[model samples]
Target: MFFASDNSGPVHPRIMEALMEANQGHAMAYGADALMDEVRARIRDIFEAPEAAVYLVATGTAANALALATLAQPWQTVFCSPVAHIHEDECNAPEFYTGGAKLTLVGDTDRISAEALRAAIEAEETRGVHGPQRGPVSLTSVTERGTVYGLDELRAVTAVARDYGLPVHLDGARFANALAALDCSPAEMTWKAGIDAVSFGGTKNGCMGVEAVIFFDPAHAWEFELRRKRGAHLFSKHRYLSAQMAGYLRDGLWLDMARQANANCARLVAGLRAAGMEFLHDPQANMAFPILPLRTHRRLHEAGAAYHLWNGTLDGDDPDQPIAARLVCDWSISSDEIDCFLNLLRA
Candidate 1:
């Protein structure tokens, strides 16, 4: 059973097939491929933003960093939660891409609140030229802790940013998972909620390595294209990325894969609960952070189950002590694997 990360999962057969089909003939390079046009059209249709500017990158960092750089100026600071992926996981790529823009951490938890965001934004740009100016507000759906920001919560936070004339960016590294959990339409969760841009994830769900950066307003398109090219994220063999995304968008496979992953996490959560494990945070999507007995941790490790030990260790002296672990469910994970993992816990 592999639960270390959704990134570890195999690519969907449809995506691989699409890649093979795309390789059969020569295509235009540098985002000029015919498949890319189809991908862009499909994304615009899905998001209901016919005017949206869509571009692909091989990594989520590129998608987020370039998108943020498009919205933020070097003299400004981005507002985000303390545990946002842009803050904790991106290795300051946003800062690099924006030419030294800083990230101002907003809430104490993984999800930011409207009041906290307002306070953070207000606290910035207070010192005039001495301090950083207010920039974009970045929100992470299916936040690092796996909790999703509800529609109203998103609206409130975006409204706060809007009050200060700051643009909004969404780090949707698990967009499909969050979408399935929220049961909201793509448009409702994003532009309608006042999001200016989004990093529409594909890798973590099932595709090989394709992420889309979508801007609801086409005004940012040229700048983003220039930034992407300057940042070296512009893929030369562009059809491969286009094929992966196109296959993902077709037949509603993206949502179906996400639904399976979320269902797997729910099953894992149920089994963990039955085993008397305590959750550090709610399992809102496809990730879970559970605190279980140290002995159980040893048992799972010895049984060849792969996952992240979030806290403590297997070799600690206190066998009965609880340790935190992160379990991620992917679309390909089978129910039998889940049962086998649960059995290991019971053992």
Candidate 2:
């Protein structure tokens, strides 16, 4: 049972087929390929933003860093939760890409409240020119803890940023998963909710490897293009990336994949509950943080199950100590596989 990460899942057949088709003939290099035009148009239609600026990159880091570099200045600070991917996971790429701008962690948890965000933003840029000025607010949905943000929660934090006249960037690495769980359209979760830019992810859903950076305001397009090229993220053989995203969006395959992953996570959560496991947070999308006894963890590990431990190590004197772990379900994990994992837990 492979539950290490969604990134470890196999590429979907449709996406692979599309890549095969894209290899049939010669195509223009860089972003000039015809497939990219189609991909851009399709995304625009999906997001309901006719004038939005769309570009593709091979990794979420490139998408987030380049987009933020375009939106923020060097002398400012980006406000985000302490566990935001841009802050904790990107290896300071946002800081480097934004020309030395810093990240001011808004709240101590995966989810940030509007009040906490207001307090954080107000606390910055107070010392004349010595302090960092406020830049953009980056929000992550389907937060690191597996809790999905509701519409009200998203609006509340965005409104706080609006109060400070700062632009808002959404680190949507799990955008599809969040949309599936929330049962909302792309527009409702993003642009309509006051997000200025978004890293629309497809790699973790079912694509081979592709993420799109979308700016609702088209004015940022040229600057983003320059930044992307400068950062070495502009793929010379770009049609492959276009093909993956094209297949992902085709016939709403992205949503179907996300729905299946979320359903798998829900199934796993129910089994964990039946096993009397304590949860670190409610499972909302494809990830869960459950606390199990160290003996159970050892047993699962011995049985060849794959996942990440969030807290506590297996080398402990207390076999009954609670250990927290992160379990993720991808679109490709079967129900039978989930049952096998549950059976292992019960054993």
Tens-digit lDDT track of model 1 for 105-182 = 997999899999988887887897999999999999899999999999999999998999999999998999999999
Off by over 4 Å in 1: none
Provide the TM-score for each candidate, comma-separated. 0.99, 0.99
Q: Which regions of candidate 2 fall more than 4 Å away from where they truly are?
A: none
lDDT of 2 at 263: 96
| Model 1 / residue 24 / CA error / Å | 0.7
- Model 1 pairs in collision: none
Give me the displacement of residue 198 in model 2, in angstroms: 0.5
lDDT of 2 by residue, 265-313 (tens): 9999999999898899889999999999999999999998999989888
Best by lDDT: 1
